[model samples]
Target: MTQVPTGETVTAAEFRLFKTRSFSRHFNRTLHISVYEIHRDHSNRQPELTLLDHESIQAGDEGWLVFDVTAASNHWLLNAKYNAGLRLYVENDEGQSIDPSLAGILGRRAPRSKQPFMVTFFQANRNQIRSTRAVKQLKKRQQKKHSDLPHPNKLPGVFDHVHVPDGRQVCKRHELYVSFRDLGWLDWVIAPQGYSAFYCEGECSFPLDSCMNATNHAILQSLVHLMKPESVPKACCAPTKLSATSVLYYDNNNNVILKKHRNMVVKSCGCH
Candidate 1:
């Protein structure tokens, strides 16, 4: 039901389930989630199962059902012994005989696009980029030091700060044209090799204007921050609006598939 955070590095994990063509009750189904790990239970030799997050979703349309599993993924990264994957169970309402959600698209028979997948984001080390020509030009121009190395404070629902205090810079969107071919993804992606995804950047201060798309709660939070300072924080520049991107890539079966990846593109950004 919510979009995952895209941080400076791989600070988040998102589980995307392609829920377009599912054999189940479509209107409103309760999706229960859980993660599997290593367990030492004496009663049985089953893997350790830990519950994660759940939400109601409609499966009638061709879209992605995203889930935040950052903690689970981080745990796996920290210890390999506990990385057994996860499960999504759809509860049947009114005892309608919805059978075990063997409904999940699994095994080698499943289509690559329809099968569940995870999306991750990361960035280069600051020390690695300090010697680049771009860095030299930015240094020559004397751009703000913070812009080069930002330790963004994480915020809820796709919002993250640039670590620029007092919001001196204007909050605005930036152009980010992504080219699959340039990224050497031409082996898989077959059509519309690139797209302008754009992104939200810069800093925004209080008394946000019409362009900032400040919510009522954000306005109140700003006022509270001004009064108490430490109790609350200012809003961050983020994507207030987003759109899906249609990807034409090859599946595991070596078939060219065109699918719409939800929230794949950032359309318009605002201070939120």
Candidate 2:
């Protein structure tokens, strides 16, 4: 276990050591919350960061050097963990050393979900930006053409409507998931701002029968219509660009529809 003095300057080597620590749920008395880099998932091109309790502090080059506040004493633990501009100390587990202050939490908040919102993990390449640029670019183009993509910025009651805890906006995308449980009045749950889709799976009470994989614009619109007269498509829908790999066909009325073949899963809503 590493010990950080209350007030001191931490060396570069010390900061590296402070970061590689692990986490232990059972702290002797109090626990100071800190962040450490672990791994990133290549499938979804997102980072996988975890918290480090006081006991897990050891020598390694993976985390940040931050002030150690007893978990019991800090009434703002939840808030601090999620808020920006927390202090960091660079030093060994014990002994006097230099402490440096840094901006915000170490890495983005890890993705968390409400009950019944199980994690459907996605992988990302080691070089996330390079690996996921196409998907992001495609979505960006779509958003540009169709300005009415459902987003938190446009939605009046984003936090209230989806049951996201207040003050959790600072949390990272990976650290949050939206809830649709008992939301029967919702004809459409627009994908939160910036994300490509919003999920409503796992034994939900809402009418999400047709929206099993609501990834693209067409599926989302279909979901709105699926709700029928009760549907309240709060956000407007726009014509989506279908991929070349998909075969386009016309229905009995000659309405163009995308074949149910490729399931393009883009970024989904998270705490951020």
Best by TM-score: 1
Q: By summed lDDT, which 10 consecutive residues of candidate 2 come out lowest?
A: 128-137
Q: Candidate 1: minimum summed lDDT over ten consecutive residues — where? A: 129-138
**On a 0 to 100 scale, what is the lDDT of residue 112 in model 1?**
37
Model 1 pairs whose backbones collide:
none
lDDT tens readout by residue for model 1, 1-272: 11222333345566665554455644235433333333333366665566666655433334445667767767765665766567555554442333323434343244532455554433334421111111011111212223222211211121232223333456777889999989999999997889998888865553344456555566556545433344577777888778998888899999889999888688777766
Off by over 4 Å in 2: 1-59, 63-88, 101-272
After superposing candidate 1, which stretches have Cα over 4 Å from the reference? 1-168
TM-score for all models, in order of appearance = 0.38, 0.19
lDDT accuracy of residue 133 in candidate 1: 10
lDDT score of residue 224 within candidate 2: 41
Model 2 lDDT per residue over 1-272, tens place: 01212332222111111232333322221223343333333466644544333333323223333322233112222243432322222333343332221211223232221111100111223311110100011111112123344432222111212212222322111222323334441233222222233231222111112222223453344234322313433222221222222334456675766553443332332110
